[model samples]
Target: MNPLFRFICACLFTLMVLAVAAPGQAQGDGWPVSIGSPAPDFRLPTLAGQSKSLSQYRGKIVLVNFWASWCPYCRDEMPSMDRLLKSFPKGDLVILAVNVEKRIPEKYRKAPVSFDFLSDASGQVQQRYGANRLPDTFIIDRKGVIRERVTGGIEWDAARVVSYLKSL
Candidate 1:
């Protein structure tokens, strides 16, 4: 390769890599998605052989949870999520319960449960929602703005979160 051409190619490659890594450069804390940024869209398969998309749940308040069966906190939070889903006063609240456990096809499919159970065996969905910790919850308001993000375990039906959802 010619020297000038090689230099140009090197610069271009460096710029591309920098662009891909730019999102992380300024962020030093825990939250992955910014408060005002549009919630990242994802399409993953549900345990019941259905596909779930974040974009499809627009026009409603969405509670996006990242959890695993092995995590005790995650296990504890399931009931709250279920209750929240069933008992929420209005039809505008939706829960997208995502499981980050390994894809155990039969067990996931056969398990009888309430609420939508989607898979993120590769953890891509989890990372997108800033669910680095088990049982992380993100509340995306009706306007598709990510309003709140709670790390670790949380009561999805808690009054504070509920009030915010209601306001949306």
Candidate 2:
């Protein structure tokens, strides 16, 4: 066999092996929640000792953020989310910050925000949403359909982002 042909065959074999090993490599973050899917309904206890469900906000745009208090990015993006909350009229939008951990961090004890911070003690809600990574966000329309799935941190109050939400 020609040496060049052997090298080409080896490379092809390696490529084939990689493709089979990681079938989901093409997906940016392997988020199971595909865009346009119905947002999974979940009831989680709020920081205020109340329970909230995604279905309750069916007539409003909902931003379901999966985050942990210790995650710096989650903390950083939260303020912008507050600003985003203020942009629209009352009841137009609902921001649900679902904390994956069991305990609410002390830092949030006094932090003022318009959004609701809920606790996912059992992590069942996180698993249901496939939020394995911190700072994952799902933008659900008024009809409860997930319009977007964001994998990482972003300026939630950016003009373009707000405009996009407004359009929805």
Candidate 3:
């Protein structure tokens, strides 16, 4: 066995082991909410002038979405979010759409909003969740552990997404 060949083989084996041991590791880098992390608790006002807290949804799957009314991505994804909310049973899942603005826009206050439209006027709750991007979303499991974190906009009602939520 040549010395150089043995060294190269050993390095390749080590790299393969590391890669298999740490699948999906890059998904958590720089993300405020990571899979397996406890979802941060927050209390914020709802569009109807009522205050709501994350703890209230314990033992159920919760989707915490941080968005601003003016964000185009947020606007685009909202309809899909509504559909996602409707897909679940009344108490099986809770979707908290936290508005990161001073006032809940009239458009959002009007008809067809199914989820809990929370008002994070001071951005405190958003900051607590580390939601740096508009339309950031965290899916928490029944145990209140964040199972998934998605940045930017995505179709929340997509079949695959719905299936994943159901599995949790």
C-alpha RMSD for every candidate? 7.4, 5.3, 7.9
| Model 1 Cα lDDT, one tens digit per residue, 1-168 | 899999999999999997887677543333467776778888989876789898998998888888777788977877777777776755678888788888644654655445788888988777656677877878898878888887787786798766767788
TM-score of each predicted structure versus truth: 0.74, 0.80, 0.78
Q: What is the per-residue lDDT of model 3 for residues 1-168, given as tens digits with 9 covering 90 to 100? A: 999999999999999997886655453343345578888787888878899999999999998998888899988998898888888988898989888888876887874868888888897777767798889999999999999889999998999999999999
| lDDT winner between candidates 2 and 3 | 2
Error of 3 at 143 (Å): 0.3
Worst 10 residues of 3 by lDDT: 24-33
Show the colliding residue pairs in model 1: none
Task: Give the Cα error of residue 111 in candidate 3, in Å.
Answer: 4.2
The candidates, ranked best first by TM-score, are 2, 3, 1
Residue-pair clashes, model 3: 0
User: Arrange candidates by lDDT, highest first: which order?
Assistant: 2, 3, 1
* Best model per TM-score: 2
Which number leads on lDDT? 2
The predicted structure with the larger TM-score, 1 or 3, is 3
